[model samples]
Target: MNIDTIELKQQQLTYPQLRKTQQYLMPARLTGNSGQPNGYDIYPVAPLGAGKIFTGFDTLADYIIKTKAVLIDGFGGVFWDKVQQQLQSCFNDKDLSVNWIYTETFLKPTGEIDALVKPFLGADDSVWGTKATFDLIDLFEPAIEQQVPDAKFDINIVIGTGAALAGWASPIIYLDVPKNEIQFRMRARSITNLGNAKVAEPFQMYKRFYFVDWVLLNQHKKNILNRIAVMADAQWPETINWMYQQDLEAGLDQLSRSVLRVRPWFEPGAWGGQWMKEHIDGLNKDVVNLAWSFELIVPENGLVFESDGNLLEVSFDTIMFSNNQHILGKHAARFGDEFPIRFDFLDTYKGGNLSIQCHPALNYIQENFGENITQDETYYILDCDDNANVYLGFQEDIDPSDFRLALEESQETGKAIDIEEYVQIHNAKKHDLFLIPNGTVHSAGAGNLVLEISATPYIFTFKMYDWVRLDLDGKPRPINIEHAFNNLDFSRKGDKVQQELISKPQVIESAPGYQLVHLPTHADHFYDVHRLEFDSSVTVNTDNTCHVLMLVEGQTILLQTADGTQKQFAYAETFVVPAAAGSYKLTNTGSGRAKVIKAFLK
Candidate 1:
């Protein structure tokens, strides 16, 4: 039955007015057990030595004055105007001889940059783009060296996103902002894409940032990690948190050998749901709905560290950049700094069905998108109503030409086609694992909370249909029938989908009050899944590979790492166990059996 025809009871539609008790939305790994858990500390700080960190702009300026010259390099979306004003004010009070050089002066013209990135930006409204091969250096003018003043001053400050390329042999202070904050700034029109002076529309701006700017900046950040003398959290406007590079590296090293949890962020969408808003505490209830929780999508998430109650958050990439080998272990050689696995939430509970979509094949993605990996994904139903369903694969008599014609006609006439006539629909149940390898057609229907496990290359969805609904901004979402047709696997239809796509659970190991069940993934996937069920406690070995896990069934569980460090995780909370963490133990803190779903690179 279609989503519109499905009858849901009134009780199924009513969400609990009270938030889920003891549901810890902001989970963090602490350096020690001395500090109390604070769900409100979004920017947790890792402790550092006494002389390593500088708090305010005044303190940062004092440290800068000690050196003759310094280059302040950072990511895009930074408030360069605020940085200039604050530092300039501090320097003037000290009567220091300062020559301030803003990197914007050396940027190539906007038209030149637009032309350079046009090939990668795709169409005006297209969501997908090939990864750019250009570097941060290419965005600057060839005569950047000449732009620097030859005369010497007491303190020469060169600052901006690409300030380090200004031909300065000075101490570099890198300012870092998380990806979520950057998107928020984009929505507020307070920042522009790299090398562009005026902010484009939010959606178009994000498209450019994801396809071009972020690609180049991430490479630049990785290149400069070793050279940065100081790392600053630039999310805040007036105040700043600066720490010595050595200390930041130390914190990363500590985390590589222990369990780590990347901070999760939530966003509202047109197909958003009330599950997260009602269950996840600390989330703002004023929004229309919380559709997706970026549980552990490392590309856009951040890792927060707490040091003496002060918090600092850095982009999750810094962890891989600093210690990929320790974090990924044997898989490090193949993936390098890229985290191969991703875990996120697709909350459609009491909302709408996700867009009927399919991802590109490995060869298609690598050739056309400049990506090393494709978006191979699986949906684990975390929770669902009685009538919840998942649309997967195709009908037995499906015809590609007819399907394409119907989709195109719908796009043209704004008419709804009977999607189930072509796509297979399966009843979704809690803990049902649905495998969606690259090129597989699939989508989570309404009234279900889905824990999406996949590879790291997200945002490559080739949508064929979107239920003929306008997006949150009252605009039609993009449809990619041609792209979907290029990748859709017609052979995965009828009974074959039920036999292959739906995983069968088999108990692999069991003991008194404990059982380990293997939820096998598709052969095309590079990762595997396991569900650990225990009433008291269970011990698991990392097996020299990283493990991404979530407490799916129970209310609370305590995780103890190999080094005897312990942390508590609540239901639906996601955390990572690095390869170097060795073995860990989980003890049920709440009553009843606790089940944790574990995903690791095979």
Candidate 2:
């Protein structure tokens, strides 16, 4: 799972010959009618194949009956209560309505768990950090056969199949909401039944929903979602659509030759920047600042494919599962079933500094998080201020033990450590690629717009320091000094860091109007980086490997596929050219020189 392996050693990894030795899985892109003038287009299936591609008057009850499941286990973001009512009315079936069970009924009182987590409310612990597990059987035994919630249990006696318990395996139906909508609903307190509590503050409830529920539960329910019967987009009636998993795979197969872009969601954070809010179109402007944009984050990002002039979104995992080799090529065999590369924005323009953090080494991430790959990442400077500086590795070595003591004392006393004394600083400019392998202490200093390119294992940043800044809610953010110290490589100090970690771009190829610069990374880095400096145009081949493109320094550019199909992207826009897309031509539509960063398997 380490992307570094996917980069250097994956050339030897190859998938079995298609249909030669394995089960023949053909292209099965989902196609549907939207009642428009145009014809049908391929569609992405909902996450876990739990929802449907098209809405109908009556289908939920029939689907349950057809699938031969006693109950329909639907779990998702806020507003499920109201969504259930809407589904009941849509189905118009008393039989189906009477069999559904809301998980809230099966809860032990909130006081027991709340008391344990209360101490770390303003400290450095997440709900998952607590050694507490609430199984459905333990809490919902009393409500098993009762109609307490006005729904009689299906006599088949399928127990606790909703949550991520051992016996929960039926036709799962996952309802989903966008991040913006979920946050809004949580803040508005649209519905109660937050595990154990009836009511809580907005920010507190938000933490439970995101950190506890989503992050901690995603892996638990991934198996159920993998073979889901239906996935609902949760937009009732008009736009609400349920998509099948097989159909989604089929749709992805059909799109092997086309480009794919997920509808990115934006979030405003405590150390957020203003670039996204000022430039990115179709974002909620009411937010104070947009810190992170999940540009190519597959697990969380949703895919959008237009069918008959109507745009429908599904989880990006559809293509990862269905079009594996076609999208990832050789790395597909190495990565098996995961998309290895990630493209995300880190905007610090006119904002504060990011947390000084480091990711665990490969073995640490694997042993601790049960992950196959570590987050091997690189930060390509997309834009930056005149005085922008990036924190990487450490300054000239002093004492590793002393550094740990200083960090701990700062955490205990609410005092800020002088970051420069221990951390190395490098001035950043446009197109400066800083190599941040796992365990390299790094941070995106303020006044720079960074395009973080890496193997997608985000959320593992073990923050050692946060510059003594408070969160958006005015509470001190969490810092993991112990975890950071355990993973920090003091050997990556002063001279070795600059000579090994910091990238130095070399012009590998130069022509009249085009030059390809090789931005060499660390030996452990599984992915390679390159800058396509072009004047008028340049032709780039996928080489049977997926290529992620970013318009780092240009107003706009055109990507022309082999079929002569073309797509234009503006400045700071990120897009992907699939492995099946073959060779594509890039025409610089801007006035001056254009630099597009192409990242893929080495």
Candidate 3:
């Protein structure tokens, strides 16, 4: 491609739909509990892809020459198909022919091409006379044979289903550079399991507990795949016959019995000699030498690089699973197909009683000339100190400007708020439930361990105040005063949260546990809070409903597998079990009382 031609074509490639779609996804307004609706409230699921929407036109073709750029950030179907059809019609003119670009950040193909083209097309690369796009011949045909190793191929495919959109095709594409040669790294996409770790406990260990939901790693010119194979058998817990009930336990327990102490993750020696034989030791030695290892692997946040010396390579992209449209709230894409929304349970080690500041209302933020805000949070106070004081909402009506001044002062002077202005501060107790509507200023006071259930996943935090914890760089983080000020409403004072116990709230003998309405939404906002307490083992048959089981007080075994096979979790630990776990048992194994919170859409 000539630079002169690129400059000329750049101006002609104007994508109008791109601009419109970007605006459509950006969260433009905030929403409140019971207030006037704001005009700018845009609750787009994923707004980061707001910039890449566009289409490519052929410019010259006889019939309805169809070539278009379908930019899908996450999951797209009827909505996108309708948009694609409209674009096809728009570019069907005699003078203009349509060409599809299909631009998508989350899409593996787009990311791969972008990653490959970036280095060669980069300004620094021009000094070496490298071009932007290379043909297949140039990409694979190595300059030397002895320097490179054998290449291995891996492919994974799955069907995507959605409510608003059905039959949406989304597939994972993975390509690994040949091993046993000088290489940068290996990359993969949408990988379900990589049996790289050592799993010795079998049924006694927890599966997918590490939170490494996705992986992309790099190794030197060694059989990295073979290393991975050794790691897999030792890491993941698969099913097998068990003579006793203990055989149905997690593998971690089995390993713990041998090791005497339970460890968080695998120890280096746990890989054993079998794993060491597969060049694992040699690869480990070589990995530290690489200058740069790029694995466009999507972890929690984004891209990461691991190296084992030799040459350097780059990955295409990385995406967090929570943000992954296909598996956002579902156990997996298959379960998500049946249930669109994914209900997640978060156990913040430090977010117990000393909670952060509250967010603003959607209407106030949108109308009052401020940034977009989404604030709807609920908490199940599983445990709290006897004298713990949880402050929430305002005590009395106040001038909005005064509240603004208070926020400004907090931002400038490190003060949270004018303590005098706080509305209803209550001493929160254990087993209490609270509904925090948008715009209400509240925090989970210190020493209060709780289960938080919220509306959306995005973090629209307005730091009213902090315990004054300095950042790693030793700087006080700036607060968004203007936005937080607009959200605070002094008129409505929220009430204390109490467990709704109607003696034996309507019992569902068919269902496992009884639903004790702790805090009703009252106004159908986000979710209905409930406390599920049972003495005997309860059978919960999941029908596409994912649950975040948090053991507050005692140990409970989540019987997931068919028959009696299950994984046991103790207090303070939380598990996001898939609805596919099907009908499982929640057996109490601890000595004392067992308390847990069950949050789902009713």
Highest lDDT, which number? 1
Q: Give the best candidate by TM-score.
A: 1
Off by over 4 Å in 3: 1-356, 360-375, 414-417, 456-458, 467-469, 489-491, 494-525, 558-564
RMSD of 3: 22.2
- TM-scores for the candidates: 0.92, 0.75, 0.43
Distance (Å) between predicted and true CA of 271, model 3?
38
State the weakest 10-residue window (summed lDDT) of model 3: 229-238
lDDT of 1 by residue, 1-602 (tens): 00111121222123222111111222212223444232222223445545555567898998898976888999988888888889889998988778888888888999999899999977776776788988888988877655554366778888898877876777899998878878877776878798887878888888889989899999999998888998888876657878888888988998888888887888888898999888864555667887888888899998876554345678999999989999999899999999999999999998999999999999999988889999999999999999999999999999999999999999999999999999999999999999999889999999999999999988899999999999987999889999999999999999999999999999999999999999999999999999999999999999899999999898888899989778777788888999999999999988899999999999
- Measured over all alpha carbons after superposition, the RMSD of each candidate to the real structure, in angstroms, is 7.2, 11.3, 22.2
Q: Against the true structure, candidate 2 has what lDDT?
A: 0.64
Question: Which regions of candidate 1 fall more than 4 Å away from where they truly are?
Answer: 1-53, 146-152
Error of 1 at 186 (Å): 1.4
Looking at model 1, residue 274 earns an lDDT score of: 92
Q: Would you list the C-alpha lDDT of every candidate in the order shown? A: 0.84, 0.64, 0.32
**Which sequence of candidate numbers ranks them by TM-score, best first?**
1, 2, 3
